[model samples]
Target chain A: MNNSEYAITVKDLTKKFGDFTAVDRITFDVRKGEIFGFLGANGAGKTTAMRMLCGLSVPTSGNGRVAGFDIVRQAEMIKRRIGYMSQNFSLYQNLTAEENLRLFGTIYGLSDREIKTRSQRLFQDLDMESMRGKRVGDIPVGWKQKLAFVAATIHLPEIVFLDEPTGGVDPVTRRKFWELIYKATADGMTVFVTTHYLDEAEYCNRVSIMVDGRIEALDSPDNLKKRYDADTMDEVFRMVAKNAKRAE
Target chain B: MAILNALIKKESLHIIRDPRTLLITLLMPLVLLLLFGFAISTEVRNIRICAVVDRHTDETRAILERFRNNEYFDFQGLVASTEQNRMLEEGLTDAILILRTATGNMESQIIVDASNTTMAQAATGYIESMVSGQSGNSPIISSTLYNPQLKSSYNFVPGIMGMIFILICAIMTSVSIVREKETGTLNLLIVSPIRAATIILGKLIPYFILSAVILAIVLMLAYGVLGMPYSPASIVNVVLFSLLYILLSLSIGLLISALVRTQLAALIVSAVAFMLPVVMLSGMIFPIDNLPIVLQWVSAVIPARWYIAAMRKIMVQEIGIGFLVGELTILASTTAVLLTLAIVKFKSAVR
Candidate 1:
């Protein structure tokens, strides 16, 4: 595929800590307007790689381009063009939902009028108009998760990197959370998400299973299941992750 | 600039909503002012004393007699050498005067329980003065020049100011920053398109204003409540110097937040670990001269030491600006170094 056709193009990306390699020579491409799943067990180095891609951390070696900007030299430019929702889904608990959205909007350099207008639209779009002025802490975890997603995508970057956005929640809420991701992709925003849930991998247009700091398998869930001759994505994951000493 | 303003406003809301932060920011200075000013005085008084004398001499008798009459000593009467340790360990005596005479002139030692540093120092000091007065030779008359009344608050107000600043600016700032880190909000800020400097400055600006308000409150209490002398001549210098000190403390907080990974670690370091040096080595209560040689070296780096010294000169002595040159230079340079180090560490440590 042409480099410009991809929203994220990573070539031999690696990260090392003193004597141990955390993310070792991983290469992948994520197309625009697709929900891409990064699957790994605990300690599989998924978050480290995502952080490097998002410019929150520097890679030890290799090259990456996110939203058409070099990850290393153009980290600031890349940051401007991408949005991130960290593992915690960290909206300020003390702030009202509107305040949280406004804070993120303004940080993206949106004018006050723009922030107000867009946030109103976002709350409505998410069907979360009732949660606008309530403190985030006082809200349920499910609502907090949705608000955090809205905050991340408030500026409407070309790419949204979600680091395990739904780790702990009811199965019903998790399903609704995926709907938000679907809505974003429908708006032509690329979605890069990490989750340990094999069921969620099926929601992605394509998924990569990481083992021992490298991508052991990368394909659509149907293709991976077919290749592994497995009835479920869980079996496909276990088949590839069987060799991973790092998976805890 | 608009982003910074939003961040500051958001942070202000956080501070207002957080009871822990609000308590430390608002009520802490008042408690510390009273705690140091009246409750926990350093001016040692009415010490319990006993003596173990090996020789009976007119000189020794005179010294014991002086102790009996002195208002600072309780003069608990003579105890045998065998009872010396028992008296001290049992807490019956704050100090034991041990006098020995092999030659014509008697030599003496004041043995005190060294655990309570302030009490030990005071006990020994009173005994030394009593002993010197007994010796026929004329003793040097050294009276306090600045505070003739020798009120402990005169010394404590500056120290309270030092502590209040550290608690608010350093401890509170670090905790606030690390709270973001703990909640994972800091990573969001770090990943934002904005410069890291803007996020840090915005996070700290609210605490800076809180520190300023506390500074005003403390100064007013020191003058009105504690009856500290309000020297108009040096007031401007005091405020300016304190402002610089606040920045220095804020930088330390930034540096701490950068170094630590958790809010608990940041709180432990900034609140508990940092306060020990401020109280002990900063000459806040104990004179630096009385500190061990190693601690004196350690105190040289404590920003509060320089700040408290500058404050004492400015508030108590009403000293001229020329007198503060050394202190001002040290404080300003330390602030510069810490601010640079904090900014650099903040940028690198997050990675």
Candidate 2:
């Protein structure tokens, strides 16, 4: 399995676009099989730092490891073991849900039988069997969100990164979507998700609050709420994010 | 290889589902070829014609002087008869006139490159009228060279091939790639283990195959329905030339995809910035010689100018492959440059 105690580890990871440091020397760790929340206001470098961790972009200066593979030199190996869903809900809308699953699974080098069995298991777990053959564009946005998760995890990747997977999703649907995330982590698959919504941070095993390209606070949601003298994660986030210099 | 197949399969699914890709690649060629073939009949202006005088005299000088001063033609001044084939074949002039007093009387013969049917027709008409309209006119005999049939479709076939190949291959490929960028799927692709070059190849191979089908359909219609002249001996030439031209068009699409981040912008640039010039200035429907000086310079770098011209030699004239050396070199080199630029730009753009 090659599973480490920590699914992701980083030290002083920084990403600069010219003089502007979008992700500035931030450090964090995500334990294996836990729901790790990455929270920030818009344009606070959540996407950039997540991209660096997911092996999508090179860090300007620092270090990162995902699933025991170095982010810089072993990016390809990291990619083979991880799945990603981008901020905009990025499955093929033209393809049927099953077909999208098949496509990603195949890209991860899964056999037809393996893709089919995994797709069946996901559909059953989500109770989305009736909609499996329907085109993703024909489905509702919440369903598309769930289908994207299925596509990302179809190959049984060790870790999955979701950039605002619940953005634009209804509040009730977002809560329901958490059930699937819980089930995934129950199977020992690590999840790293980014969101601007502080309410979602309450559901994480640990949450990091980033403000203006730096992580101001990182801890369990309960610990952050207690430390900030707040009753909710929203207050904790507001306490940290109040001094942000960057605009959305 | 499995990863590539998966990508190709996914890309093919996108191509099949998006009616725009199919509509452009499959139908654009047929419609443009048919519309331009029968519906359009435009008179050429500023026909560049040069003359070869065997022996100079007062009468011949007067005749040459009239053409030189005429507004309807850009006279490429007195060239030797030995330079006759060189001038027309290299596109220095549309046609050449052979004038002589070695036969005792002024016997003038006109030779126009039949590749450009409209310009050839226009140039031959103007020179014949000029000889007859003059005072010391001789026994004038006219002949259009290259191929005898000179079907008007010869003009439209090459022109439509140039316009629609760019429109379909470049526009569709660019829009498809850019659509991924717009939908945010390209970020997902980058996160995958696949290299940028593999992604590009998977995206392009399907279009390249579709381009081959479109080429076959276009050629079949041109040779069979429109009665354009094509010899059996030039089949290999047509195949090789079409393959090279398709590769060039696909690379242009890839470059466009790398430059633009939005699908709408890709479509607009491919259709307007590129295809429009091919139609307006590639000697497709209008004469390049007729364009203003600056536009003439603009048309000079247009690849279709060379593509349509060479297609004429291969499809219409059925000339030897040697005749297309200049056009082949231009297309091949441009393709190489564009492919390199596309790969480099694509890597940076995607990241």
Candidate 3:
């Protein structure tokens, strides 16, 4: 396959801690501009796989490329091209929204003029002009999550990895967050998201369900549901999880 | 360069916005100066004493009168030698001066409470001088060269400088970094394009600048309020030594943050492990030479020991760098070793 066609390509990627393998020879490919949902039970090793692909953790063995850079040898190059938002809200709570944006913008190597204009556009996009000067700790969790997502993609990275981005929030807020993800994909930015919420899995163009450190299913949500003979993505997940060898 | 600038700006904003950190950093030096300067004093003043004369003579009476008139002694009246031990046990008197006439010559004995050895030594010296002065023979002609009055504050000021700088720079920096780790922001920072070394140096720059500011305030109070000697050469020495000490402290903080996983652990370790050693083993309060041989060997490893010694030489004696090369070299090497270790630990931790 042409490397430019895929934002992330992993082959037999594995990570082990002592004798226990956290991720056991998982393989997958994510197309550019695709909103790929990585769904897993709590200990299914989804986050470990994402970490390896983000160049944050080393794979025990196997080959992986992120943004056309080798995950092992070109980790620094990969870091420069991709953005990541962790499961926890990672922005500085003491800093104002504008300050956080300025910090991430500069670290991402954006020029002063670009940071200024892009931040202004971001504030307008989120309808958060009033929050530009507010400390992140003072903001609601929903707003913080949305703001964190925008900050992660502030430099227009080719791929933005969101690890359980909408973990705890109201349904309406989670819907609004998915809208932002859709907007990024529309702008030709790949969205690699991990979520435990089965309902959110339906929003992805393609979904992979990991069980027992292995991908049990990877296809469009419609195809997964039809193949499992299930009515909903939740049923599809349940059908796949029954075969997991590792206990939750 | 841009990444470092952004990090520094963010760190500065954090310091400014956090009232607790700001309050401690600003007020610690002044508070410590007052506590160490006036409260923890070794200088003897108005020591309580009882005079016991078994066979009174004109010379004994004259000596008693002199003791009564002296300002260093608060005469607690005459006591029988049999009652002296009870008076001392009840804390009525700090010492007893006994005079006996024997074969046309008078023999004097002084019994002192030596629980606090430094204060006891000073009191004995004072009594010896007063008694010898009345014997028509001049007392030992001794003069304090640098500090004529022998103020304890002069000795404590440099030590306070060492303590305050290390406490603020090392403890604060480590706590701040570990706080980021606990809150998970450090992971985001590591995932960014900036190098780990850049992140560490960026975090340290603001602290270095803040420490310099604190040093300036402390020196001002030392010279302005406490009457510590100030000269251009002394000021240069202070600035140079303080900068080196700050670097050593920052690197130590970085090493701690790299090793610890939580903010609470960082706070506890920096306080008990780092701050305690500076206070007890740095010769800040107790003299290193007076410490046990084992502790003396341990003290040689503490950067604050060399720092406090160098500061005293510079600020009090107004000495040149020729006298401080050994201390400066030790401090520089400690900084180098800690910094290299911190960088290596941080790199591996990031991975």
Best model per DockQ: 3
What does the lDDT read for residue B7 in candidate 2? Answer: 83
Q: Write the number of the candidate with greater lDDT, choosing between 1 and 3.
A: 3
The C-alpha TM-scores of every prediction are 0.87, 0.84, 0.95
Q: What tens-digit string does per-residue lDDT give for candidate 3 at A1-248?
A: 22589999999999999998989998999999999999999899998898898888999999899899899999999988888998876899999999898899999999999999999999998999999999999999988998899889999999999999988888999999999999999999999999989999999999999998888899999999889899899999998998787777
DockQ of each: 0.71, 0.63, 0.83
Q: Name model 3 segments beyond 4 Å from true.
A: A1-3, A243-248, B115-118, B136-140
Q: Compared with the true structure, what per-residue lDDT tens digits does model 2 show for residues B1-351?
A: 887888888888888898865775687788877877766645466888888888887778988999889888888898887888889789888878888877778889999988977677878888988876676446666687765544567777888888778887898789889988899878878888788888999998988988889989988888788877767867678778888888899999999999987888998999888988888989987878899999999998999999888888887778888988999999999999998999899988876
lDDT of 1 by residue, B38-155 (tens): 9987678888999888888887888888889989889999999999999988898899998887676688888988888888887887788778777757557778798998889989
Segments in model 1 whose C-alpha atoms lie over 4 Å from true places = A1-3, B44-143
What's model 3's lDDT at A112?
93
Evaluate chain B of model 3: give its TM-score.
Answer: 0.95
Worst 10 residues of 2 chain B by lDDT: B132-141
Q: Kindly list the per-residue Cα lDDT of model 2 for residues A1-248, writing each as its tens digit.
A: 45569999999999999999999899999999989999998889998998888777899999989999999998889999999987768888888998888888878889999998888988998889999999888999888999998888887789999889998888999999889889899998999999867888999999999999999999999999899999999889888989888987
Candidate of highest TM-score = 3
lDDT of 1 by residue, A113-231 (tens): 99999998988887788989899998989989998999999999999999999988788999999998998899999999999788999999999999989999999999999999999
Better of 1 and 2 by lDDT: 1
Give candidate 3's error at residue B239 in angstroms. 0.7
